[model samples]
Target chain A: MPKHTIISVSDLNGALKDVVEDTFSDLWVEGEVSNFKAHTSGHLYFSLKDHQSQISCALWQFNRKYLFFTPRDGMKVLAHGALSLYPPRGTYSFVVKSMRPAGEGDLNLAFEALKQKLAAEGLFSTHKKQKLPRYPQRIGVITSETGAAIQDILRVIQYRFPMVHVLLIPVMVQGPGAAEEIARAIYQFNAQSDPIDVLLIGRGGGSIEDLWAFNEEVVARAIYHSTIPIISAVGHETDVTIADFVADVRAATPSNAAELATPDQREVLQIIANLRYTIKNRTLRKLEVEQERLRNLRGSYALNRPRMMLEEQLRRLIEIKRQLLRTTQLQVQQARTSLQLREGQLQQLDPNAPLKRGYVQVFRDQTLLLRANETHPQQLLTLRFLDGSVAVVVNEVSQDR
Target chain B: MSQRLSEHTFSEAIQSLEQIVRTLEQPVPLEEALSLYEEGLSLAHFCEARLQEAQLRIEKLSLQPSEVHPSTL
Candidate 1:
C-alpha cells in the first residue's frame, strides 16, 4: 500500500460514483417500492427494498414519461438503470431508466387483482354486455393501422358482409400511451353524432408484453362502459385479456370479430331467394285454386247448359197450368150442381108448379089472396088456373073459412 | 316506388316482401292479390339490386396524437 495522502470529500465521492456507475450500469434490480414520491417537476423518487436491505431510486421526467403505470408504495417492480451517486452528500442511488411490475407472475397477480376489483364493481357481469346488432351497417374498428389484424378484419368483413361501412380508428396497440389511445378512440366513436352499430377492438397474435395495452384498466373500463357492442379479439385463441372479459363478445381472432359484427350477405341472399320462390309458388297455388273453383262453377248444370235449365222451368210451368185448369173445371162443376139445387128449391116454392100439379089460385081483380085473413069480403075475384083465369062476381059473397 | 325501395334496407325490404307474400296466401280479392303480387315482385327486384350494388367501404378516422395523450389518464 502507498503512503496516505489527505483528500477532499468531493474527490472520494467522484471516485466512488465512477466505480458504481461502471459496475452497476445496465443491471436489473427487483424489489418492492416504498416511500414513493412524485415531485411537482415530474420526477419520481422512491426506494426499492427487500426484507434484508433497501436502496434509493430516482426516475427523471424524461424516463418517467415512458412508464406504463404509476409506481406506488409497496408495488413490486423490476427497474432497469445504473447506480448513481451524489458527491456532495457522499450518497448513492439508482437512476432508473425504465420500470415494470416485477415478473410475469406479478403481472398476472396484478391482472387478477384488477379483475377481481372490477368484477366486484360489476364490470364483467353478463347483464352488462350489450347485444350486437343483427345486421350492422356501420362497424367501427379499433386497432393499429399497419397490423395484420386490420387486414384480416377487412378481408373477413368483405367476404361475409360486403355492405357494411367499416370505420378504422387506428391506435397504438402497445406502448406507453396505447391504452389511453384505445379508450379515447372508443369515446370518440361514442361522441359522434351518427353512432356506429358495433366496435371491433383487437390486435393480432402477440406476447403478453405486446398485448399489455389491452389488459390495461383504462381499456377495460372503456370497453365495459361502451354503449356500442364490442367484440374483443386481443390475440390468438390462447391469449385472454381484461378487455375480453369486459367486452360484449370475445372473438378468437380479428376475422372472427368482423364476422360476428354482421350477418352473412350470402345467407341473406339465399333467404331472399327462398322468399321470392315462396311468394311465387304461393301466388301460383292461389291462382290454381281459384281457377279450379272457376272451372267447377263453369261445369255446373246452371252454367254449362243454360237452355236445359230454362226447358226444365218451362216443363214445370206447363204442369202448373194443367193443374190450374183441372182445379177450374172442378169448381165449375160444383157451381153447376149448386145452381141446379137452387133452381129445384125455387120450383118447389113456385105457385105455377103447384097449379101444374092440379092446385088452383083465386084472386080478386088483380090481387090474389094468399090467406083468409088477407081477403076482402065483397070484391070481384078472379079464379086462375094453370092455363086460364075467370072473373067471379058477388054470387059468392059468403066467405069460406 | 323506386324512391320508396331506395329508402328500404335489405332486411326491411325482405320483411315487407314476406308480409306481402303471407297476406297473399290468405283469401284476398283478385284486385288486391294482383297488386300484392306486383309489389312483391318489385321488392324482390329491389332487394336483388341492393345486394348487387352494395360495396364494402373502409374509412380511417384520422386522430391526432396530441388529442388522445395518456396524460389525460
Candidate 2:
C-alpha cells in the first residue's frame, strides 16, 4: 500500500465519465412529464418521473416539430432517446428523439388529437353525411354472428317490417384486425349489385379499450366516407365513439336501429283495412244520398207532371203554328196586292193592251215594229191585230203629219 | 280497354286499384251500378291477392339458405 501510485483528479473524472456515458446511452424510458423547461439554446429540458424515480430529459428543436401534439406537465409519455451525461453539471440526462402519449391511460389525449385532425379534414362535416332511406328494402349488419345485438335487431325488424331483408355481414367485433375486416365488409357490401339499403355498424357494450376499434381513425373515416347511410350502435346507450360522430345516424342500441329502419307491418295492415272499411262505408253513404236525391228529384212538380209537360209542349206548338199561319197570310196578301198593282202597271204600259184598245201592232218577219223608224220602205211586213194577222208589202213610207 | 287493363304493370295495377277505390267512393247506386261496383271489387280482390302472393314469396325468401324452417310469419 505504501508503494501505490497517486491518481490525478482529471484522470479520475475522465474514467468516471466514460463509465457513465456507456451505462446511460441508447436507452428508452416512460414516465409522466414534469417541470418542463426550454433553454435559450433551443433545447427542451424536463424531468420524466414515475412514483419511485425521476430522470432529466432534453429534446432539441430539431425533434419538436415531429410531435403531433403539444406536451404538457404531468402528461404520461413514452420517450425514445439516448441517455447522455451533461459534462458541465456532471449529471446524466436523456436526449429524446421522438415521443408519444403513453398507455390506454392517455386515451383522452389521443382522442382529442385524432378528433382535431379529423375535424380539420372535415370528416365530421354535415356535407359528408348521407340520408337514410325512408323505407329500406334491405339492411346490412356488421357484428358478431352469435351476438345478442343481431338477435335483437332481427326481432325488432321482423316485428315491425316483415318484408325487409336483412343481410348479415358476419365479422368479429373485437380483437386483432377487426376494424380492417369491418371496414372491408362495408365496402364489399356497398359494391354489391343489390346493395344494402343501410349499414348498421355496431356492437354490444364493452370496456372502452374493447370498443377502441370503433374509436380508431380508420374506422371513423370509413364510416364518414361510406356511400350508404350508417346507423352506429356501439356499446351501451352512454358510450360514444369517433364512429358515432361520422355516422349518418346514431341509435341507442341495435334494436333501436331496427326500429328506425322499419315501420310496423301490423299497423300498416290495420290501416289498410281501415281504409278499405272507410271507403266502403263512404261509398255506401254516397250511393244512399244519391238515391235519396233521385227520389226527391222525381217527386218535383216538373218531373211528376209528365202529361202536363206534353200538353204544354203541344199548346206551345199550336201557338207557334197560329203565328206561322198569320205571318204567311199577311205575306201572301201583301204579295197579291203587289202583284195586282204590277199587273195594272203592266196593262197600262202593254202594246197588246193598246192593241186591245183598237190599235194594231205591225211586224216584219215575226219581229214587232215598235216605231215608224223600225219600218223600211218596199219591205214585206206582217201586220197583226189582237186576233188576226196579214202580210203586206210596203208601198210608201211617210213620216207622221 | 280490356287488353290495356290486363296489360297493367305491377305499379300500374296498384295505381289503377287505388283509382278504382277513389272512383267507387263517388255517389253511384250499388243496385243501379252493379257492373261497375263488381268490376271495382274484383280489381281490389285481384290487387290484394297479388300482394298476398308476393308476400308469400318474400316469406319463402326470408328463410336462411342453410336451414329450412316454416315461414308462416
Candidate 3:
C-alpha cells in the first residue's frame, strides 16, 4: 500500500549514519559540556549543549587519556570526533577521539603562575617547612568526609597504625567554596590549644580542576602558616597541586599520606621486642660477672697460707689438750691410792687409839719427861687417859730405847 | 621509684629501658646489678603491655557548606 520506496528503520539509520559520519568526521565541535557522567568502563557520556540544541557525546576511555582537562558540566571544550548512529534507536551521537580545554581559562597556566608567585614569596621554601612528628598521636584530616580520600586514609591507617586518633574536619573538596573551606579548616585546627601533631589535607584521584581547591592561593598560604606539620595529598600520583609544594610534605596519594603520617606498628613492636632482648642479655651478663667474681674470691680464700697455718695450729692445740687431760686423770687415780695407804698407817699410830687401848701419859711440873734424869721439884703433874686425868707433884722419868 | 616506671608510657619506658641496659652492660656491684635487673625486667613488661592496645578512634566534625571565613584567606 506504500507508494514511495519503503525502507526498514535500521536501513534508513545505517544510510544516514554513513552520510553524517563521512561529512562530519574529525571536525572541531565547540560546545559547553552538560549532564556529564563517567561510566564504570572508563567511558565518558555527556551532552554538549548551547542555547538552541544539545548533542549527545561519547568519549571512550582510550581517547580520554589524551584529554588535557576533565570535561565537566558547564566547562567549554573543543572536542574532536565523528558523528555516529545507534541503529536500534535511530539516534546520532559524537564519538569524541580527542578533546582539549577551551575558552576563559587554562588550569596548567594558572597552576604554573601561582606556583611561581608562591615560590618567590618563599611559601614553599624548605626552611619554612616544619618536620613531621615521628610518632603522631592525633592526625587532623581536612577533606570531604564522603570522599574516597577519607575512606582510603582510614583503611590504610587502620591497617598500619590503628592506635592513632583520626580527627576529620570535613570540608568541601571540589568546585565552588572548596578552597576557602580547606583554608579555614587549617586555621581552625591551628587555633586549638591542643593542636594535632600533623594535618593531612587532600582528596582522591581527580582531574586537575577537581583538585583545583588544593591549588588555590588561600590553601597554599594556610598550609604555609600552619603550626602543625601538613601533608598534602591531592589527586593521583601524577597530579601535583600547589598545596603539595607548600605543605611540609607531599604524598603521592591519600593512602600514601596516611602511611607517611604514621610509624608502622610492626616495626615499633619489633623495636620494643629487640630492646627487651637486649636488656635481658645485658642483665644476665652482669649477674654472670658477679658470680664469676664470687667464685674467684672463694678460690683465693682456699689459697690463703696464713689461714691454713692457723687451722694447723688449732689442730695441734686440740691434741695437746687431749694428752694433758689423760695425764691429769692418771695422776689423780694414783694420788687417791697413796692417800688411802697413809690414812691406814696414821690411824694405827693415832694417840686417841692408843689411849682407848689402855695406854696413859704422865706429866711432872706441867711437863711430861721421857728421861728419868729429868727431876722436878714441887711441880704439878698431869696424867691423861681416854676419859680421866690425874694431877701429882712428883718427878720420875724412865728412858726407853 | 618503681611506681614511676610503671606509669611511664611506651615511649618513656623504651627510653629508660635503653638506659638501664647501658648501665647493666658495665660490671656493677652485685647489689646494684640485682636492683637494675629488676627495673629492666619491669620496664620491658611495661613496653609489652602497651603493645596489646590497637584501638582506632575516629571523630568527624561537620562543616556547613561555604562556612569558610574569607578574611583569614
DockQ list for all candidates? 0.36, 0.06, 0.29
lDDT tens per residue, model 1, A154-221: 99988988777899999999866577789888877877776688999999998787887887777887
Candidate 1 regions with alpha-carbon error over 4 angstroms: A1-32, A35-102, A286-401, B1-8, B21-30, B64-73
Q: Single out the weakest 10-residue window by summed lDDT for candidate 3 chain A.
A: A98-107
Cα RMSD of all models vs. native, in order, equals 10.4, 18.8, 19.4
**lDDT of each residue in A1-401, candidate 3, tens digit only:** 76999898888988998899889876668788999999999999999888899999999998664453567798777677889888888899999876655454766755676788788889989998899976676799999989999999999989887767788999989865577789888988887675588999999988777887788777888898899999999999999899999999999999999999988888877877787788778767777877897888876856676887898899888889999999998899889988999999999888779778887877665565665556555567688878988876765544565
Can you rank all candidates by TM-score, best first? Answer: 1, 3, 2
Tens digits of lDDT, candidate 3, B7-61? 3255567778788778877777777877877887787776666556667779887
Candidate 3: residue B36 Cα off by (Å): 4.3
- Of models 2 and 3, which has the larger lDDT? 3
Question: How does each model score on lDDT?
Answer: 0.83, 0.71, 0.80
Candidate 1 chain B least-lDDT 10 residues: B64-73
lDDT of 1 at A204: 96
TM-score of chain B of 1: 0.67
Better of 1 and 3 by lDDT: 1
Comparing 1 and 2 on TM-score, the stronger one: 1
Q: Give the clashing residue pairs of candidate 3, or none.
A: A372-A397
Work out the iRMS of candidate 3: 3.5
